[model samples]
Target: MTFRTRFAPSPTGPLHLGHAYSALIAAQEARAHGGEFLLRIEDIDQSRSRTHWEDQIYDDLAWLGLSWPRPVMRQSERTKAYARAVAQLTDAGLTYPCICRRADIEAAAGAPQEGVPQFGPDGRIYPGTCRARVFPESQDHAIRLNMAKAVEGLTELSFVEKGALFAGAHRLDAARLVETIGDIILVRKGMAASYHLAVVVDDAEQGITQVTRGADLWEATQIHVLLQRLLGLSTPDYHHHDLIRDDAGKRLAKRDDARAIATYRADGATPEDVIEMVGLTP
Candidate 1:
């Protein structure tokens, strides 16, 4: 099969230097392999995702000289696809309704046991309060995956990145793969789809042969891979690149507008400079 990769960005805020780096790398890699580079707008967060931000994504990416293969895909318009996948998972007994609130989890897991609360790829770890409860037919709650049972029939799970900074091809951590990510949420309380479900379904629908994103999402790949297996979808090879961090070593966020692409453009910084800022060759 021909090589295909995508740079999926959530259009909730302005594109930042970090976004530039990832897009450039993905575009360059696709070009290098004579592959197709696609762009996907992860606008699942309807509350925060705005038309302005979506337009900014197109403008910034074009300004940075990063071209997409075809017309971009917006996740907000693909609710029905995500809903279908969720229904399939629910039918397979892989998903359960989670009624536990954030406060309940925090109160249940008082005080840090060992240093800070152990966090995996999907942010803070869930204490699994609603794991045992049998969700009623009329129960209105978020859906959670039965990760423990899901990974039982599976033997080995791994992926490879053709190019990487530290390890060219990284291996998946087996022990932490199952333990750290236990019963992750698939659908939010009122939201139609969750990140895990949406991402996997979108990736499959887009025929993403490989995924190139920040290393911070490395752990989350396991969840996606697991979902692929559960849904009988093909898993793509993954490349988790080093994240762009600020001087304080925190990952660059949308709140840091100073690093926004618009700011850089206004400050007379060229697209090449934006690529260089991400430690990539312009």
Candidate 2:
């Protein structure tokens, strides 16, 4: 089978070293296997996405000697697709409307000492405040996925990574995905769908065979897998690679303009130097 992968970057900010590292790794992996590499603009957060940043993405990738197979796929242009997926899940009785705000969920669930909320990978685990509420005449609130029924009887969840399969079951720690993430926000209040829903639809639409990115999103794999099963879409393999950090070991951020690809390039850094900086030798 032909291998297919994608480098999906949100255009909310400039492309930093972490972004470069991830994109290069995906590109190299595809080339190494004589597979296909695709570029996807995950600009769903319309509030922050900017045309300037998008242009920079193209410029930075080209400067790094990376090329994608087709015209870039932009998520902002795919809202309708995500809406359809959300509707499908809702029709299947796998999603519900959530009225709770972030603060409300945190207060309801009580504050945990470490990490984010246990439900879903996002950590802002919905406390299911509206789970028992009768479906309001109108859904003015965000929608959440009803994972309780969706994952029933599935004791083990596994996916392929780095030519091997890794399995995780039930909850990540003390919080059960079903109860903690019960009725996750599939749609944000006025928004049609959440990132989890849109991304799953996009991945399947793009025919992506494997997903490679930072390990920080490891928890989100479960959310994607559950969505795929619910939508009857094929689940792709996942490889959560290590994150690029600074001398202090903090994960790279868009605010770290000092590490932006454009900044490094202006400083006379070669593409090979960028690869070396990110720990990708090729």
Candidate 3:
């Protein structure tokens, strides 16, 4: 298969140094392998997604000397696809509706059983309060994959990792997934789909052979792999690279406007300079 990768970013904020590093790394990898590098707009959360920020993403990436084929794949326009995937999972009895809010989960997890994990990849591993509840027709709720049900009969679950950390073949533990990850949200309330569900479906549709991103997302790869198996999608190779950090050694975020690519450009920094700042070759 032809090698393919992508740089997917939410247009809710500015593309910072970390974003530059990831995009450059993906584009560089594609070039080195004589493959294709794609850009995806992860704007599923339309409430925060803005046209101006999306425009700035293109501007900033172009200013950094990176280019990709257009028109780009925007998540907002792919809700029907996400809904279909959700419907498939639901029909297979691998999904359930969840009406529990954040506060409710916290209260339920307050008194945990001994040796039970308090957190997982999806943050505060779902308490499964709504796992046995029937799907309410008129009530608003999110959808969650039943981890235990999803992993049934699925042995030999693994993926290739080409990143710096954990660079090798890794197998997923089914029991660990149930205990730690729990039933993660596939579709969030008031949103078309959660990141986990959307990304897996999008990667398959885009024919992405490899997924490149920051190391912070390493833990979440297992979830994606599981979803791929459940959805009968192909699992891609993964490259989780180092993250760009601030002076204090913390990873850069969209909120860190000082480290934004646009800020550097405004301060008269060139594309080469920005690339060098992120420890990449021009």
Who wins the TM-score comparison? 3
Q: Tell me how candidate 3 scores on lDDT.
A: 0.94
lDDT winner between 1 and 3, please give it: 3
TM-score of each: 0.91, 0.89, 0.98
Clashes of 3: 0
Candidate 3 is scored at a TM of: 0.98
Each prediction's RMSD over C-alphas, in Å, is 2.2, 3.2, 1.0
- Predict model 2's lDDT versus the native: 0.79
Q: Kindly give the number of clashing pairs for every candidate.
A: 0, 3, 0
In model 1, which regions exceed 4 Å deviation?
111-117, 135-139, 165-175
What TM-score, to 2 decimals, does candidate 2 have?
A: 0.89
Tens digits of per-residue lDDT for model 2, 1-282: 789888999898889999998898888889888999899998888888899999999999999999986678998888789888888877878776667777887788875657554655666666668877776658578777766767766544555666222433333321266644655567786565678888889999999998877788877777777778778889788767788999999999999999999999999999899988988775
Candidate 1 lDDT trough over 10 residues, lowest sum? 165-174
Q: 169, model 1: CA deviation in Å?
A: 5.9
Error of 1 at 130 (Å): 1.7
